[model samples]
Target: MSRVLRTPDARFEGLKDFPYAAHHLEVGEGLRLAYVDEGPRDAPVVLLMHGEPTWSYLYRHIIAALQDRFRVVAPDLIGFGRSDKLPEEAYYSYERHVAWMREWLERLDLRDVTLFCQDWGGLIGLRLVAALPERFARVIAANTGLPTGTGMSEGFRAWLEFSQSVPVFPVGMIVNGGAARELESAEIAAYDAPFPDESYKAAARVFPRLVPVTPEHASVAENGAAWCALERFDKPFLTAFSDRDPVTNGGERIFQARVPGTRGQPHVTLPGGHFLQEDCPDEIARLIADFAG
Candidate 1:
């Protein structure tokens, strides 16, 4: 797993003073995990996992707001953010993702976690929780789903094709296009903080492509196994999916119907697109804190 580390200047220059303890953990032979560890050491943990294109930076505002009360731990997944970049598309599989995250979590000894997952975060994070349900206290899913491939929205398919065919995975520019509001110059650059170029975007390029479109996908059976575990996961579960985000719209309904943990919970409709944190961090934070109570 020998890998290249992308040292994006904008990421470091702009975020040098951000209020979080940045740490990198050795997860595998060539993979190192980059994460922000903040707030009281004794506070209950809120583990945040991001999706495609964006890194841990996506949670900056939410981290700041909640770190004061909870120990926030958000990691940049291997390909998308400030973590190691492997150029091989073959290296970027659903199995690799779950394996990488599990190794990192085991190394960090993460437990009693209030897991918050969005986008790919939910895809990978739900597998983590389902694999070892004892480690988590509750689960808050926002604009994310653990796909079992019973139905995938057409919006997701369109975006999936775009990511695979693009010459360069412009993390920042693509993110701006998806949002309802125009991003400021600083905000756009902030999203681009991770990758210096296309060389660092293998994870972003392959993540969308890795989503199981049909039950025959390589990891479909594994996802089904996770779903089987989730069928009886009687824990605190809340869904705060956004009203926009065509790609993931109604995904919460699938979880609510199948996952026992989400039964009878209030489903929140937030005002934003796919990257709702960029659109309404304050509201998302409020919902998490309110639900965690």
Candidate 2:
């Protein structure tokens, strides 16, 4: 584990109650990527990738439920949760994020993966799948989108603006925004646990800005390439988004329209805000298992 994962917040020490066993894969160059490698190591793998402001911790319930039948490997994307954070903005870019995760995957040598991505997880993970389709067998995306933003709604625009302009890094508010209801005190603290102060929050604070909200944004060309690749992605694909999330409503339509194997699979609208897993983990887990079947 890198020194960066060891935060001043001791509250996460109690997170051992979660079923997945922790492991660190040195993705090289002082980067010790933290992941929960659970269930049988030989079981077919499902790679769960999280989005902005959240870590692999977001998938705790899903991990517990699926680890018994499937090998669950969920990594804290460099800078978000237990992974190392680069205090410098220069280190965090869409291209850089893609490359960094490419290295992370190379270290694991994961094959025949079923990708489970939400929020920015879908953004990054999908690009990875497009880049190396052979490594992944299937994909399930929730409350997430490719974010070409060419055909996105005005609501998304307003939210993008608000996220960038917000002065304080309101981790609690953002997490609670997608939550089905008010968060418990402990859960709120868990979201707030990674940061000792503003310094440790560079990644959380920068995530919203990293999203390509407009057609001309910096990540546009890269996502365009990924989309072109996805157009021909012939593997099983599914979308499980929240009905109430205005930010991503109809986003799945793009995937269904574009991706090859997404034609007949179940695409459901789960109940909750942005963070559907926190609100309704049981349904999400069952749906994912059913997808696996």
RMSD of each: 1.7, 2.5
Indicate the TM-score of model 2.
0.92
* Residue 253 in candidate 2, Cα distance off native in Å: 0.8
Q: Using lDDT as the measure, which candidate wins?
A: 1
Top candidate (TM-score): 1
Evaluate model 2: give its lDDT: 0.80
Model 1 C-alpha lDDT per residue in residues 1-293, reported as the tens digit of each score: 54666665446665632555558887766677789899888888899999887888888889989988998999988876667788777877899889999999988888889998999999999999989899988998988887766767888888987888878777788888877678777777877777777777677787887888787777888998998998888898888888889899887888888878887777788888998887888988888888777
TM-score of every model versus the real structure: 0.95, 0.92
Model 1 alpha-carbon drift over 4 Å, by segment: 8-10, 16-19
Stretches off by above 4 angstroms in model 2 are 1-11, 16-21, 149-152
Q: Candidate 2: give the clashing pairs.
A: 178-274
Clash-forming residue pairs, model 1: none
